[model samples]
Target chain A: MTRIRIPPTLREEVGGAREVPAEGETVRELLDDLMAQFPSLRRQLVEDDEIAPFVNVYVEGEDVRTREGLDTEVRPGSTVILLPAMAGG
Target chain B: MVSYRDLLAQAKAEIDEVDAVRAKDLIESGDPVIVDVREQDEWDEGHIGGAVHVPRGHLESRIEAAAPDRTRPVLIYCAVGNRSAFAAKTLLELGYVEPVSLAGGFTDWKRNGFPVELSAGLDARKRARYSRHLLIPEVGEQGQLKLLDSKILLIGAGGLGSPASLYLAAAGVGRLGIVDADVVDESNLQRQIVHSTERLGEPKVDSARRTIEALNPDVEVVAYKERLTSENVDRILADGWDVIVDGADNFPTRYLVNDASVWHDIPVVHGSIYRFEGQVTVFKPGEGPCYRCLFPSPPPPELAPSCAEGGVLGVLPGIIGSLQASEALKLALGIGEPLIGRLMLFDALNAEFSDVSIRRDPECPVCGEHPTITEYIDYVEFCAGTREPA
Candidate 1:
């Protein structure tokens, strides 16, 4: 089991919980499991099978893109965070 | 000038980049101080909450004040990672410990749904009182509310405090705390306009409270009628003021105020006057010169005369304190430059105003990168050290 931290803006779609637990061996599988549980998060995070440019995924404090994108391995109990670009003062 | 490509390459080679996960871990573990090296405008739009703002252009100058410890872990980031790379390299070169650039800046941090903060809006009555300020696009409703929420501390009730308190109260500063241990004397009426003849013999803080209350009820004035010594300076200033106005008359209190303000990282609006001359500057810790940066040591008492000893023109405080008030307002509203890194001099005799550029001293005792005096010192003794046979 891995934990995904949801941001404030997306909390409503995740039953208003800040963190949700899912199961997977890789970032792609973990995200797939997360989307299966909360279908609304899929479109917000994925665009045509690639993580949207606006959405960033971090696996255990490392950006998955800098590693191997969705192929980055995630050990059980690893923490993943999803973030979208925020341009504010 | 070096080409951008070469500069970026050189900076990149000298620094290490941390992936977003490592940066997050550092933050979660509370082991690193996060710095946003973006322009002010970019910062106001959105930034990682709790990240200190030390823009890339001024990183070297301000980093010491923002993070005084050379051994603290620092996570530096910009819009992307490029500017932060240079910032990280500079921090390392300056002896900062464990400096790293966030691999992906706020852009990616946000895109991935990371937490970002937006400035909240203003309320209605405030919108009406500061409508004139709101007319200016820069200080519209958003800036007005910031002003209403700002806490300003004034160190004296004489001279400079007169005009500074009056105008700041009128400008709608939310909270103004005044510290004055003296009672209003007949001589104070010469320049301390905030205290009238009828208020003579009353504590200056009480006198000032009456004046501010009459001018604007919107402002709340907290009066501390005790002199600020090393013992109480820290406790009094601990409440967290947005800005501090150094209106103290003596060198000891001035140095005490400067040291405390530097230690707390609060910007101080410094003003002083002689018979026909006065000077004003915004002494921002680390970002610009603290008082000690300009005057490394206080002058010997024989040479340093207070306004009480050397007669001052009655209107001197009005001119100087008004300028202090303007600077405080600008600082609170976050609109216009706040006179940081520059000292403005006014000579009433010649009716001339001059500008002196002030640079932060990398070696300043109080705010230097390797600061020796992190805690408040016995300022009286420290200033007196300058008087010894030198």
Candidate 2:
């Protein structure tokens, strides 16, 4: 199980939960598991089957885009952070 | 009891005395802690290069701070040899291994054509105002002077800009240039502490200037009652600035500022806030990754909302903006490790802080090995999602 931390903007879609537990071996599988529970997250987090350009997913403080797109391995109990660009001053 | 001349002769006989030529040799050959035990006026006029000033009256109490290692050799001097001779005797009593007094002090050193350092020190008023900063070894008189000579420009005078401008002004950043097209709104008072209820209808730049001037008269504020756009960025940047603070409230402005800063080769201290969370980082052109490297494109309106759309916690900008001020100060003074390639995330609700590493992208449009976008484009249209990012 991976603990995925939700950003404030996505908390509404995640039912106001700061974190949610999911089961997966890679980033793709984890998001499949998470989006299965909440269907609306797909529109915000994904674009045409790839992670959205504006959204950054981090596995243990390392950006997945810098590592391996969606095929990045996710160990059990690893912390996943979903970060999106914010423009508020 | 002995007379003053008798005591002076006794002290001179006990301490080792070196002539001006010998003193210069010791200073050049080795790293001896040099002490000038002269009065403030005399020391300020001229003294040996790299000498720490400790007046004769305060020698016993302050010598340890000037030279903590008593085993190292200490070369003491004054206006003439008499005062330094007594000071050397005092150091020997305090367990110093070797205390050598200059035979003719600064007078002889000057006559020998050796180097002398003259301090353009602060006035009495400024000395009292920044006394606390002087006590710190890292931000001593030198660092404070650097701050007073620095020139920083701010993008906005709103939420994040309010606290950042206030703190930077209080720290005595010599020149501050503010760019904002908006006026002080009644709704801004919740977090925009730089403005007051009395100045609700005034322009943000004017209001901020008045507040900053009142806080610290040492600062000079330059007000630009216009938005930062490609057409005017060159004109504004032509004024010259050492550092830029970005606190704009929209993606278009943020992207424009980033591009301008990269082209101008100036470091930017960036801060952004959303409801309960904030982000802070320093975007140095060549040293670290820029905003384009971090986020290639802006999110669609549905995904990313401004603070106006999504209300922010009142104190969130205060925390993030103050962090920006600290980084700017460090950059101005050339001290401490700034957040060059690190992004700091602050969660107010969780009371937690985390950092992530950011790296420069070789394919970045603006700052890359082979740049494609050499000129500024329509930032508003680019951020409006009218066209997909390349």
Candidate 3:
């Protein structure tokens, strides 16, 4: 079971659960499984099959986008935390 | 003497409380008389527009005059929820039928981007002087008044402070306090534009004040002709400032400003410059990671050369200082998303701006959950320890 932790901004669109469990073998599969349950989150997280530029997904502490994007390996007990870029002063 | 927690707990048990959302709803729906019980300076920075002003100490004596009707819904708030809880209990005991405490208080209200109004005080002349600012929809009458009522403490009057203070003063920041111990040097002419050729030997604070006052007579500049040592950091910040602008060039003063500002719950607009690079961020205590959270400790002395040693581009401070001024104004207005958890890196040579996401370290020495540094530490000694390169 891979745990997908949602940030506060996207919580409302996904039933407000801070953490949701999904079964997948990779980062892409985990996101697909989680978004399948909550379709509303798909639009916010993904745009035309690519992760939104603002959203960053970290698998086991390393940013997956920097490593392998959606193809990053995942397994049971792996934690994926989503953080959005905050462009500010 | 009774503990503050005991009093707050007792008050909580005795009064009804409303969250910031519910409090806003109450204000929108009916004629609830909102009263802010924070200190006078905090109230001046920004308050829930139309909220009655009754400092917690005087609430019992002045509540009736501010909101006399016992039947009316009286909502009260302090810095956080604690003081307001006690104020609510006092209001309930004063025979008010529907007295409610704002659960998270003014800080929460401000963080939510709710409307805040300054008390009516800016004269027509001052308003006309700020006509250009008022023209912008984001910085209209309310924002201009907010600018006029805000107090920003610039930790240095050189380099970064030069442009930041100039713009802040021109923007009609109600009170601008400048802290700098050094005298303007001939070398400062290259970057510290706040001082002129004639004012070379004058104190930086004095020189900066003269420049700012000349720029805008409406601004009141308080000159602290002294260094920001650990001894005076708390004392200088004790009066409570809306925002703290870190313009210091040294590691010790920079860290001192961070710790003091964080302890006081005042957001710090931080900026730093090297030879051709600069960075800007807002170290909002409890809101995001502080300077300590970002650097943990100063870079080894040799690695972190002074501006004199590592010659900055003359215009670099102008760019980063302008950003600091912008951040301070945003904080004062309680509008726009500040760089609370983001560090903006600037490369002058390449003219590139990149942002790095910075999160608060839960184990951070100063701002962590179980923190070790409660008060200001010996930052000078801490930074002076020359260590071997790892």
Each prediction's Cα lDDT score?
A: 0.78, 0.88, 0.78
Per-prediction TM-score to the true structure, in the order listed: 0.55, 0.87, 0.59
TM-score for the second chain in candidate 1?
0.66
Candidates arranged by DockQ, highest first: 2, 3, 1
Candidate whose lDDT is highest: 2
List DockQ, one per candidate, in order. Answer: 0.01, 0.55, 0.02
Off by over 4 Å in 2: A47-49, B1-39, B48-76, B81-103, B381-390
Q: How do all the candidates rank in terms of TM-score, highest first?
A: 2, 3, 1
Identify the runs in model 3 with alpha carbons over 4 angstroms from their true place.
Answer: A1-89, B1-121, B381-390
B87-115 in candidate 3: lDDT tens per residue? 88887878899999999888898888889
Give the local distance difference test score of model 3.
Answer: 0.78
RMSD of each: 30.4, 4.1, 18.0
Interface Cα RMSD, each model: 22.6, 5.1, 12.7
lDDT per residue for candidate 2 within B54-86, as digits (tens), equals 889989988897899999999999977999999
